[model samples]
Target chain A: MANEKRVISVIVMNESSVLARITSMFAARGYNIESLTVAPIPDSDMSHITIATNGSSKVMEQITKQLHKLIPVYKVIEHEEMVEKEMVLAKFPIAENLADISVLASAYNGGVVNVGKEMIIVMAADEPKRVKHFIEAAQRYNPCEIIRGGVVAIER
Target chain B: MQMSGAQMVCEAIIAEGVKTVFGYPGGAIMHVYDEIYKQDGFEHILNRHEQAAVHAADGYARATGEVGVAMVTSGPGFTNAVTGLATAYMDSIPLVVISGQVPLSLIGTDGFQEIDAVGISRPCTKHNFLVRSIEELPRILKEAFYLARTGRPGPVLVDIPKDITVETGEFKYPESVNIPSYKPTYKGNKKQIVKAVEAIKNAKKPLLYIGGGAVLSDAYKLIREMAEKTKIPVVETLMARGVMGHDHPQLLGMLGMHGNYASNMAMSETDLIISLGARFDDRVTGKLSEFAKYADIIHVDIDPANIAKLVDVQYPIVGDVKQVLEEMLPLLEGVDPDRYQAWREILKRYDELHPQSYIDSDEVIKPQWAIERLGELVGEDAIITSDVGQHQMWAAQHYPFDRPRQWINSGGLGTMGFGFPAAIGAKKAHPEKTVINITGDGSILMNMQELVTAAEYDIPVINVILNNHFLGMVRQWQTFFYEKRYSETDLTFQPNWKALAEACGGIGYDVTTKEEFDAALKDAIKQNKVCFMNVSVNRFENVLPMVPAGGALFNMMLPSPELADSALEDKKGTK
Candidate 1:
C-alpha cells in the first residue's frame, strides 16, 4: 500500500497525562506523526487534538481504532470533507524587499505580525498544504528562522 | 465526612467489593499500609516481592474473573511490578495496580524511592493516573477499577503521591463511572451476526478459533454451544485452554506453535473460521499470509482495534464474545451439524494418526506422561498455572481441563516466573480447589522465593517442577535451529529444589520414578501445606509439533519421521 498523508482529530478528556497517553501510543505502534496540536475546547473539560500523519490506509485504520481504545479519547475523526489550517512564522532581515514579502504573505492569507530592529516576522495562516507552499515561496527573502505550528482541523 | 486519603482508598476498595489485595509496602505507601492495617473489610497478602504481588493478583483475576488489585511503593518498587503489569496487559487480564510516588513537591527532585511510575507504565497499562490531589482520590480509584475490569479488560495503574495519601479529603465513592470518552461497544452489530450465521451454515469445514478473550469474557459455555451446534472443530490458543474439554469431540486441541497436528492442520484447512474474542496472535497465526488461507474469517471481539488489525476479515463483529455469540446462536439454530460431518472425520483421522505422544520408559519419566498422570491425580477441577517453557506446553497438551479459568499461564508475554505466584493467587481465590504451578527447572528458580510467601500465608499450592536440568524450551530451539550450541541453556548448576522448598517452610519431595512421583503428589495433597515436587525427567525431551517460528501451520516438525511422512502425504493428498 502507498503511504498517504492524513489528518485525524481526537477529542479527549483534559487530563494531565492524556496527551502522553496518545503520543506514546503512536510512538509505540510505529505510526508517524508529522504534526500534532492539542488545546482545550471552549467551555468544556475536554481537549481537541489534531494529528497530521502519513501512512498506509491499513495502518491508518488500525491507528484510528487504537486511538478509540484510549480511555480518555471521546471521539476520533479522520476528516474526509474538512477544513484544516496551519500557521507559520517566518523572520527575514530588515534589508529585504518589504513590498514583495507583504504581497507573498497576503497571497497566503497572512501579513506582517511584528517588526523588530534587525528582523521582520511575517505570520501566515492557510491550508496546511498552502502553508508549505508559502514557506517555500518566502525562502527567496533569506529568511532568518521559520517556526511552523502543527495542523488544527475541523469538519466541514 | 472528612477522611485521610488513605482511609478513602480503603473505603473505595471496600465499596468496589474487592475482598483481597496483594502487595508489598514501603515508605511512600506507608500511610496506605497503615490504613490497610486498620481496615476490616478486605484482607491483604504481603508478598515478598512487588513483582510477585502483581502476578499473584493477576493469577487471582484470571482464575476468578474479578479485578485483581496490587499495591507497591515508589521507584524500585514500581519498577519491580512493571513485568507483572505488562503480563496482564498483554493477556488482557483485569488488574488495578496501585503504586506510591514521591510527594508532589519532591516528585522531580529525585526524592528517595521516587520514580515516574505513571510515565513508565503508560505503554504497558491500559490506562494510568497520577493523583494530583487528595480530592481526586475517590474518583480516580473508582475509575481505575472500572477501566481495569471493563472493555477489553487490562491492567490499570494509579500513581499516588505520598502527600496526597496523607492529606484530608471528603470520601464519596461514585455509584458508577461516567467517563464520557471511554464507552466500550458491548453489543455486536446485528447485521454481522446474521452474516456470520450464514457463513457458519454454508461452511463445510468451519473452525472455532478461541483465545484469551473468550476466557476473559466468561463465554466458554456459549462457545461450546456454538461449536457443538455447528459441529465445527475448535482450536484453542494457549490462553484459551480449557474453553473446550480436552476430550471433547469437536476440540482439535490447541493451535499454533506448540499446537497438535490435528488443530494446526484443521486451522489450515478450515473453510470458515469464527474467531471468538481471539486476536489471531502471531503465535496462533504462523506465517500470517498462509494462516487460515482457505477460510473466510468471522471475527468477534470486544476491542474494535483487534478486529482485522492484521488480516482482513469477511465478517467482523465488535462486542463481548458472549453477547456476540448470544446474538449469533439463535440464528444458528436451524444449521445442520451434518454439513460438517466429513470435515470432523478428517480432523479426527489426523488426530489419531499423529496424536501427542512420547516414548514410555520405566527408568526415565517422560514429561508428557508425568503431566497426564498429574492430571489424572488432580482430577478435572484442578486449577493449573504454568510458567513459560516446555513444561507449560506439556501441561497444556496433557492436562484434562474442562472449564474456563482452569488453565492459567502467561500466554502473550510468556513470563518465566509467572507460575508460582499465579498459583498462589489462584489458591488464594479458591482455597478449596487443588491449585498447582507446573514449572520447568529453569523457570521455577526465577520466583522460587514465592514458596516462602505461600508458606507464610498458609496457602497450600503445589509447585510441580519438571526438572530437566536445562532451560528446556530454549535448548529445544537450539537443538533444532542452532545445532545444539546450548549457550547458557544448560542449568546443571542449580540449587537443591527439594531442600529449597523445605527451607522455605514447605514440604519438599525429590522424586525420580513414576511411583515416587505419584506417592509424593498424594502425600503432598494430604499434608495441606505448600509443597514443591521436584520430578526429574528425561533431559532431551522437546515439545514437538512445532511450526518453526514464521513457518506455515501445516509445515509442522512432528516428533517421529513416520508421522512427518504421513503429514507430507496428507498435505499432498489435500492438494
Candidate 2:
C-alpha cells in the first residue's frame, strides 16, 4: 500500500515560539503532514491544530509517538471515532453563469449565496473530503478566486 | 433561594460541561462544599489527598482526551495539589484547577487558611488568575475551561475569592478566545515541509526516532505506514512504547540511557534521526551534547519550542505530527533497501550477543525471573504501571508493550508514589484492560493510601510490588556509588504484606520460589478481588544486564565473558 492518511487534532497553547517549535520538528523529521488547520478553540486561551497526514502505519505511529515528547504540547490527540467537518467559500465571476449553481452550493453543507455588483460568492460547509471534491468540481466554473478553510473536529 | 459562592461555582462548572471533579474538602473550601451538595449530575470523587485528586483528574483527562477539572482550597489544600498539578504539567495533561482563596478583603492579609494559590502554583500551571469581581466570574470560568482545553493544553488555575461567587453578573460565555499573543501553529510551513522531503529522499540511512509525540499527534497509522513504505527502522523511547506494535520488525525498541545496546549503537551509526514529537530527554541521550553524534537530526513536532532545544537540527517542521507526516509522505522517493544493511547486521549481532542475559544459577527467588514470567503470563497488552526504582528499569527493559499509553510510569517527574494511583487512573481509563502496578517495595508504600482509593472505587488494578524490603534503587546506588553504606535504604517497618492487603480490604498471596509464583499467578489473575502478592526473595537481588548511571551504553555489565563462563560452570558444579 502507498500510505494511509490520519486526521490529527492538536490542542496547543498559542504562543510566539509554539508554532515554530512544532513545524520545525515536523520539517526536520521528514514526516509528511497532509492537511493543516490552526484556529483558537472556542472561549479559551489555547488553539486547536487539526492536521491530516499520510504515511505507512509505522510512520504514523512514529509521528504520534513523538508528539508526546514536545514540552509545550498539552495533549496530542487523533480522533479514532470522531465527527470531522470542514468549510469552504468560493467567489465566481457573476458573468461565469453561476446563477443556476446556487442549488449545487446548497447540496454541499453551504448556502446563502451573496450576489454583489462585481462578483457572485458561494459558500459550502461539509465533510473535509466532500468539500475538497466540491472545490475540485467548482474549478471548471471559472472561479475568479477560491479560498478553502481548514477542518474542525469534535469527538462524537 | 440563597446559594453559597461554592454552589454557584459548581453550577457554573456543570454548565461548562464538567461531569466530574476530583478534590478534597477543607475549611478554606467549606463554602465550595456547601454548593457541591446542591449540585447534581456532576460526580464528585473525593480523593484521600488533594494530590490524588489532581492525579485522578489527569488520569481522566489522558484516558478520556478531555480537559480534566480539579478543585481544591487554599493553604494545604492548594499546596497538596502541587505534585499532581506538576505531574499534569510535565505529562501535558490538560486540567482546570479551581482553588478557593480567602475572602477578597482578607486575600493579602494571609488569613489563617490563606496561601497565594496563584503564586504558589505559578511554575506548574499554564495560566492563572485571581478573580477580583463578580462580573469576571463568567468570563473567568469560560476562560478557565478555554485555557485548559486549548492550544498546547496544560493545567490552568482560576482562583476565586469566596466573595466573588457571592457576587453575580450576566453569565456571558464568549464564543471565541481572542488572546493576541497566544497562537498555535498547526500546519507545517510549505517550504520546510518540502525541504524535509528532499532530505529524506537523499539520506542514506533515514531512521525514525519516535516518542510520545506520535501518539499525541494521533499519527500512529501514518507513522507505521511511513516506516513500512520507506522501511525506516523505528527506535522508540520508553514513553513511546506501544505507539506501534512491538511485533513490527522495523521497531528497534526503547532507546536512551538503558536503551537497547543495538538501538544506541544504531543511533551512533545512522545518518539521519527523524525525531517526531519526542524531546531529547537525558534518559534518551547519554549526554545531550554527544547524542546521535553521527546523525543529521530532523525534528517534527506540533510544539514550536521543542525544535532544536537540545540538539541542533538541520530541519525543523513545526506542526502537528499527523499534519507534518502527510506532507512528507509523497515527496519521499524510495531509498536503497540495503542502505542500512550493515547497521542492521551490527544491531542484530548486538541483539544476539547481549540477549539480555540474567543470572539463573541461583535456585533461590530472582527478581528478573518474576518480572519475566509476569510479563509473559500477563501478556504483552497488560498495562504495566511502575514506581521509580530498579524494577521500573527492569520492566522497561524486559517487558514488551504492544499498546500505546500501556506503560505508564512517572517518567519525567520520577515520582515514587506514582504507580498505584496511576494504575487506578489507568484502570479507570481502560477498565477492560488488565492494569498492573509493578512497583518496588519502597515506592509502593509511599501512596499505599490509594489502596483504599482502589478499594473504594472497586478498581482492581493488580499491585505487584517487587518487594526487596529496601529502597532498591537507592540501595543500588549505595552499593554501586556510595560504597555499600546502605544508610536509610532498609524497609524494616513494612508489615506483613499479605496481612496488610487483607486489612486494607483486598485479597493477598505470597510467592517464595519461581514454581510457587507460577502457580500463584494463575489464581491471582482470576481473583475477583483486589489482591497483593508478597513474592519473597532475598533483598540483595538485583536487576542485571545493567547500564550504570551517566555511563556509556556500550560499556560494562553484560555478563563479563568470565562471569558468563563461571555462571555456567557453577551450574554444572552444582548439578
Candidate 3:
C-alpha cells in the first residue's frame, strides 16, 4: 500500500528565521514535503502553517512531534479529521450573462460581489479540489483575474 | 527601517544581491526609476530594445545562477519583455523582469503604456503581480524574489504603476514569504530510499540514469559519491552531460538517440534504474511502453505531477535534488553491489557491435572531426553555445560534459538566433570565462545583430560558423527525408570573411581546409575582438542517430555505413 499523507497545521511567530529554518530542514535533510500553506493569523502576531506530507502513520506522528520542537512553533496539530475549505476569486468579463455566472457561483457557495461597467468579480468558496474544477469550468467565461486564497481547515 | 512600497521593492532587490539591471526608460515608470536613480548601489544597462533587455537579463541569469533582473516601461515595453520572459520561464531559469504600468487614476481609461502586464504574463511566469498600492511593494518584491529563486526556478514580473512608486508610508520588507499552495517537496522518503538501496544491492545490473537536474541542483558531487559507493554505471541525458566526470570508470557517457554505445547498452541491459533529475523526454526513452522493461524505476524529482506522467515509476520521491541527495547520502554509507557480472559482459558485446568512430575522407573535412578537435582543444570547461541545426546534433553527439550549466544551448525553445545573443550574454555574465558560439551559417545570420553587442562589450566570443552554404539541418532533412529536392535551403553569397568582420568591427576568417581551421581557431582565441570563423564545409554532412519528428530514440538513422566502404573503393580505383 502507498504511504498515507498527513496534513499538519503549524502556528508560529510570523518571523523570518522560522520560514528559513523550516525550509532549511527540508533543504538540508532532503525531506520531501508534498504541500505547504502559510498565512498570518488575522489580527495575531503568529502565522498558521499547514504542511501536507506523505508518510506512514508513525512517520507522520514523528513529523508533527519534531515540528512542535522547533523554536518558533506555537502549536502543531495533525488534521486527521477536518473541514477544509479554499477560496478563489475570479474576475470575468461583464459580457458573460450575469444569470449564468450567478447560478455557477451560488452553486459553489459564491456570488457576484461587484459589477463594474467593464468587469464582474465572482468569489467562490469550496473544497480545495473542487475549487480547481470551478476554476477550470470558469475558463469559458474568460477570466481576467484569479486570486486563490490559502486553504484553512478545522478538525471535524 | 520603514518606507513606502516603492522603497521596499528597492531594498529587497538589493538584498537579493543584484548588481546590474537592463531596462528601457519611460514616463509610466518614472517614480520607480527616480527611486532607482536616488539609490547608490546598482547600475542599469540601457537597451535599445525592450525585448533585447529581457533577453540580456535572461542570458545573465543562465550564465550566472543568480536571478537576472530587467525593467521595462508599460504596455508595448511590457509586451516586448513577455517574449524574453516566456523564453526564460520555459527554460526554467531564474529572472525578475519588472515593468511599469499607468497610474491607478488612469488605469482603466486606456492609459498610455497600460497593457495588463500581469494578466498577459500569467501563463508565462511562475508568478506575477500588479501592486494596487505602494504599501505592499515590499511584500510583493520579497515574494517575487523568493518565488523566482525557488523550486523549478522561472521568471517573475512585478508591474508597478507610476503613482504607487511615488506614494510613501510606513514600509518594511517582510521577513518571510507565506504562499499557501506553492510548497515544493524535498528529501526522499526513508522507506523509498531504503527500497531503492535494496534494489540497487540486489540488481544483477544496476544503472544510475542522470539528467540536467544534477547540474541545476548542484547534485554532481552526491551523484558521483553514490555511483562510486554502489559501483553502478552512469548514463546522462542531454542536459545531464557534465554532471559527472565523463572519464570515470563507472560512467557510460550520454544516453538517448545519439548516446554512446556504452550508454545505450547500459540502459538496454540494466535491471534497476535510478533517475536523479531528468524528465524522461521521448528523445531519451524511445517507446515509453517498451522502454527498459527489465528495470524497476525510481524517479526522484521536485515536481510532484511528473512522478508517473510517463513510464511506470516504482518509487517516486518528489523533492528538490539537492535536499533529496543530502538526506539519502547517509543512508548509502556502506552499500555493496551483489550482481551484474554477466550483464556487464553483454553490454561489452553490444559496445563491440555498435561502436562509434569518425571517418577520414580525402575529399571533404568531416564536421564530426571538427567537433572532436574543438572538444580536444578547448577542453570540456569552456562554455559552448550552439544554434539549432545538424551541428547542434553533432555537438550533442560528441561533446562530453559532466556538469549542468557548463554547456548552454536552446534545448526546449530550439530558437534559431539563440546562439549569438546567448553567447554574448554568457560572456558578459562571466567576463573571465571563454565563451564559444557555434552556429550554422543560416542560424548565425538570424540574430547577427548581437555581433554588435559582443563587439561593443569588447567581449572576445569565438563564433564558429559551420558554413555549408545551406540551412544544413533543413537541407539534410530534404536529403534523406524529403526526397532531396532542396528548396530555399541554399544561400548564394555574401562578403568575404575578413570583409564581413571588418564591416561588423570584429575579426573574421574564411577556413576552406582543416589546416586553415586549426591555424585560424588558435589565432581567433588569441584575438582581442569578437572573432568569427566561417568554415566552408561539404554540403552533404548529416547527423546520425536521427529520430524522425515523433519517433523513439532507438529508431535512429545510423551513420552512413557506406563512407568507410566508399573510401576503400576510392583507394582501389585510384591505384
Candidate 4:
C-alpha cells in the first residue's frame, strides 16, 4: 500500500505516565509521529490526544490496534471526517515587510499578536495544510523564529 | 481500619489468595519485607538475584495458571528484573512485580537508589504504575492483579515509593475492579465464527495451527474435540507443544524454523489454516510473502491487535480461545471426517520418510537420545523446563508431552538462563510433581547462581546439562552459513559441574556414556536434593531439519542433502 497522511484521535485516562506510555509505544515500534497534541478533557479525568503521521494503511491499522492495547487508552479513531487545526507563531524583524506578513496571517485565520521594538510576532491557526502554506508564504518576511504547535483534531 | 501502607500491601496479597511470592529485599522495600516478616498468610522466598526472582515467579505462573508475584527494590534491583519481565511479557505470562522506589518527594531529585523504573519497564510490561500517594495504593494494587490475570494476560509492574509504605491510611482492598479502557473481548463475534466454520467445512486440506494462547486459555480439550470431529490435521508451534498429545494420530508435530518435515510441508500446502491463539511470528512465518500462499487464514485470538499484525486474515475472531472453541465445536458437527484423508495420508508419509532421528552410539551420548530417555524415565507427569539452545529444540522434538503446561520454556524472548530458575518456580508451585531443567553448558552458566537459591529453598529440581563445551546452536550456524569461523562460540575453559553442584549443596554427576547418564538420572530422581547431571555429548551434532533464515518452510535443510533433495523433488512432483 502507498503511504498516505492520517490523523488519529485517542481518548485515554488522564494519568502521570499515560502520555509517556503512548509516545514510547510509537518510538518503540518505529512508527513516525508527525505531530502530537495531548490535553485533559474538561470536567472529566480522561484526556484527548491527537496524532498526525504518514504511513502505509497497513502500518496505520497496526498503530491503531496497538494504541487500543495500552491500558489507559479508551478509544482510538482514524479520522475520515474531522476538523483538524495547527497553530504557528512567527517572529519577523520590525524593519521588514510587516504589512505583508500581517496580511498573510489574516488569510490563515490569524493576525499580529505582539509587537516589539526590534521584531513583530504574528500568530496563525488554520487547517494543517493551510498552516503549511502560510508558513511558506511568511518566509519572505525573514521571520527570526517560527514555532509550530502540534495538530489537534475533533470529529465534525 | 487504618494501617500502614506496608500492611496494606500484605493485606492485598493475602486477599488475592497468593500462596507464595519470590523477591529480594533492599533499602526501599524493607518496610514491606518487615510487614511480611510479621505476617504468616503467604510465604516469601528470597532469591539470590532479582532476575532469578522474577523468572521464578514467571515459572510459577506458567505451571500453575495463576498470576505469579515478585518483589524487588530500587535502581539496580529493578534493572536486574527487566530481562525477566521482558521474558514473561513476550510469552504473555500473567505476573505482578512490586518494586520499591525512592519516596515520591525524592522521585525526580535523583535520590539515592532511585531510577526511572516505570519508564524503564513501560515498553516491556503490559502496563505499569508509579504509586504517588497512600490513598490510591489499594486501588492500584487491586488493578494490577486484575490486569495481570484477565484477558490476554501479561506481567504488570507497580513501582511503590518508600514514603507510601511508611504513610498510614484507611486500607480497603476493592472487592473487584472496573477499568473501562482495559476491558477485553472474551466472546468472539458470532458472524466471524460462522464464517470460520463455513471455511472449515469447505476446506479439503484444513490445518489446526495452535500456539501458546491455546495453552494459556486452557483450550486443549476443545481444540482436540474440534480437530477430531472435523478430522483436520493439527500442528503446533513451539509454545503450543503438548496441546495435542505427541502420539495423536492426526498430529503433524511442530511447525517453524526447526519444525519437522511433515509439519512444515503441511503448513505450505494447506488450503485453509485455522490459527487458534498463534501469532505469525517471523520464526514461524519465514518468507512471509510466500508463507501459506495457497491458504486462506482464519485467526482467532483474545488480542485484537494480533489478528492481522502479520499475515492478513480472511476470517478474524477476537475472543478467548476456550470460549471461541466452545462456540466453534458445535458448528463443526457437519464436517466430513474423511474430507482431508488424502492430505493427512500425504503428511503422514512425509513424517515417516524423514522422521526426526539420530544415529545412536554406545560410545558417546547423543543429545536426542538423552532427552528421549529422560522423558521415558520421568514418566508422563513430570514438568520439564528448558533453556534456549540445541538442547531446547532437541527436548521439544523428542519429549513425549501429553498435556498442556507439561512443557515450559522461554519461547518468544528466547532468554538463555531461564530454565533453572523457572524450574525452581515450578517445583515450588507443585512440590509433589517432578520438575527438570534441560539446559546446555553455556545457557546454564548464565544464571547458575540460582543453584544456591534452589538449594536454599529445598526445591529439588533435576538439572540436565547437555555439556558440549561449545555454544552448539551458533556453532552449527557457523558451520552451515559462516564457513566455520568459530569466533567466540567456543568455551573450552569450563568448571567441573560436580564440584559446582556440591558447592551449592546439591548432588552432581559427570557422565560421558549413555549408561552412565541413565544411572545418574535414576540416582538423581531418587534423591531428595537438587541434582545436576552434566552429560558430555558429541560436540559436532547439529539440529537438523532447519529452514535457513528467510527461506520458505517447504524448502528445508534436512539431515542430509540427499534427503533434502528428495523432499524438494517430491514437492515439485506434487505441484
Error of 4 at A17 (Å): 1.1
Worst 10 residues of 3 chain B by lDDT: B561-570
Model 3: per-residue Cα lDDT over B320-347, one tens digit each = 7777778777877656643555766666
In candidate 1, what fraction of native interface contacts survive?
0.96
Q: Give the alpha carbon lDDT tens digit for every residue of B20-97 in model 1.
A: 899999998999999999979999998899999999999999999999999999999999999999999999999999
Shift of residue B405 alpha carbon in model 4, Å: 0.5
Scored by TM against the true chain B, the candidates give 0.97, 0.91, 0.89, 0.97
Candidate with more favorable, higher TM-score: 3 or 4: 4
Candidate 2, after superposition: displacement of residue B233 in Å?
1.3
Interface RMSD of 3: 13.6
Residues A3-85 of candidate 1: C-alpha lDDT, one tens digit per residue: 99999999998988899999999999999999999999999999999999999999999999999998889999998888999
- Tens-place lDDT per residue, model 4, B1-575, is 89999999999999999999999999999999999999999999988899999999999999999999999999999999999999999999999999999998899999999999999999999999999999999999999999999999999999999999999999999988999898999999998899999998899889999999999999999989888887899999999999999999888899999999999999999999999999999889889988998999999999999989999999999999999988888888888989888988998899999887766667778898999998888858699999999999999999999999989899999999999999999999989889999999999998898889888879999999999888989987887788768889998889989999999999999999888988998898789789889999877778878998999888888886433223233456588
Candidate 4 chain B, run of 10 with poorest lDDT: B561-570
**Candidate 1 ranges beyond 4 A from true positions:** B561-575
True contacts kept of 3: 0.00
lDDT of each: 0.90, 0.74, 0.74, 0.92
Q: Which residue ranges in model 3 land beyond 4 Å of their true spot?
A: A1-156, B1-10, B30-40, B108-110, B169-171, B485-488, B492-500, B561-575
| Candidate 4: C-alpha RMSD after superposition | 3.8
Docking class of 2: incorrect
How high is the lDDT of residue B188 in model 4? 91
Candidate 2 per-residue lDDT, tens place, B156-260, comes to 888888777666555555667665445567788889878877777777777799987776566788988888778778888776777777678888767776666
Error of 4 at A146 (Å): 1.7
Q: Write the per-residue lDDT of candidate 4 for residues A1-156, one digit (tens) a residue.
A: 899999999999998889999999999999999999988999998999999988998999999999999999999999989998999999999999888888999999999999999999999999999999998988888889999999998888
